[model samples]
Target: MERLFGLDMQLIADTLLTAISVFVLFTLASYLFFDTVRDVLKKRQDRIKSDLDTASKEKSDALCYKAEYESKLRDADKEVEEILSAARKKALQNESKIIDEAKEEAARIIARANGEIELEKKRARDEMKKEMIQIATLMAGKVVAASIDEKAQNLLIEETLNEMGDETWLS
Candidate 1:
């Protein structure tokens, strides 16, 4: 044995041998567990990817539902407007019909009033004519009592004819 750095040569040889054995054991342990550790990590990564894909699909589905609901709301709004417009048009037509009916009724009433007025005027004229005839007959009787001769009767008659004028022919 050679004495180097005042340490025993046999002790150095034993230490080196122990270090080599530990290194070999460590390498064998790593080789045995590496596949198991890698499999666990790979399974965890696959589960995370699946979860992310599911979440993305759910988000897209929610967006599609929101769009569909918005479209229905818009269609409902248009339908409401159309119904209201149609109701307004019907109301206007009803108003016009009522106005026309009122006007027609007023016209009928006015025509009836005019007819009554004309009828009343005719009745008054007829009554006046009857009174005038009675008065003329009384005057003729008085005249006949005062004069009995043919010449006097003829003179009275001629005077009565001249007073009547063209009014007799009009009646």
Candidate 2:
């Protein structure tokens, strides 16, 4: 029953008892809920780790698909180039063939025209020769009818035949 500050021994004992009771209550609450809170935290960490793993796998899949599409695009470009090259080669060959045919046809036409020209020239020479022969015969008849003596006429005809040359009427 020693009082240091005018406080009663009963009041001090009641305060001490209340403090001890509150400490006990706190210890019991910690004991009961500590495992439940730890379990909830562990579950949340596992769920976050699983979501991160899924995101990583999806990223890897997307990268693989992108690489595959790029490879296909390159192949398609090569195929298109090959097709264009073949078409160009074929077109060049066709152009050369057409040019060669045109040259051959032109040569044939020129040769035919030359042959026709030669034939026409020969025909003109033959007609001129025939006209010359008819005129010479008419002139000779007129000269003979105008002559009064037969001997003079026969001599003149022989001299004219000699001057005309041997090959003039032979062909």
Candidate 3:
């Protein structure tokens, strides 16, 4: 090759230097790409960790809410048991009172019946005694009025004189 432009050596040297600079630039660009990719991956990991932390917190909150609900349910159950116990006691008391009242009423009715029966018996006995006395007095008066004095005197005195002569006939 002849020096046609009188710059043949300088052109060849400049072409070599341009080739080296392009190679260095390509290497530096590849390194920058790798570093940026690493940074993006780290950021993704941090984001994922934050998301996991939030999930754990939510789970704990849910557990707390469930525990609170269970506690409230237990309290409500205890209250219900107490209410039932009170209701049962009240019902028993009412039943006892009702039974006592019924017994009292029964006793009163029996006492009243006994008193009425006694009164009836007394009235009947008094009426019977009064009737008996009246009948006895009437019979005694009739008997005495029919059986006394004049008849007795005539029969005794007249019959004795007549019977004195009849002694001969008797022999």
**TM-scores for every predicted model:** 0.52, 0.56, 0.53
lDDT: worst 10-residue window of model 3: 162-171
* Residue 71 miss distance in model 1 (angstroms): 1.5
Pick the winner on lDDT between candidates 2 and 3.
Answer: 2
Global lDDT scores for all candidate models = 0.81, 0.80, 0.78
Best by lDDT: 1
Q: What are the per-residue Cα lDDT tens digits for candidate 2 across 1-171?
A: 675866778889988999899888878876888778878999999999999999999999999999999999999999999999999999999999999999999999999999998877667657656666665566567777686476766676577667766565443
**Pairs in clash, predicted candidate 2:** none
Quick one: ranking by TM-score, best first? 2, 3, 1
Rank order (by lDDT, best first)? 1, 2, 3
TM-score comparison, 1 vs 2, better candidate: 2
Clashes of each: 0, 0, 0
RMSD, every candidate, angstroms: 6.8, 6.6, 16.7
Output the worst ten-in-a-row residue range by lDDT, candidate 1.
162-171
For 1-171, candidate 3 gives per-residue lDDT tens digits of 665677677888998999999989878986988679889999999999999999999999999999999999999999999999999999999999999999999999999999998887777766655654465455445545666466654554445445544442232
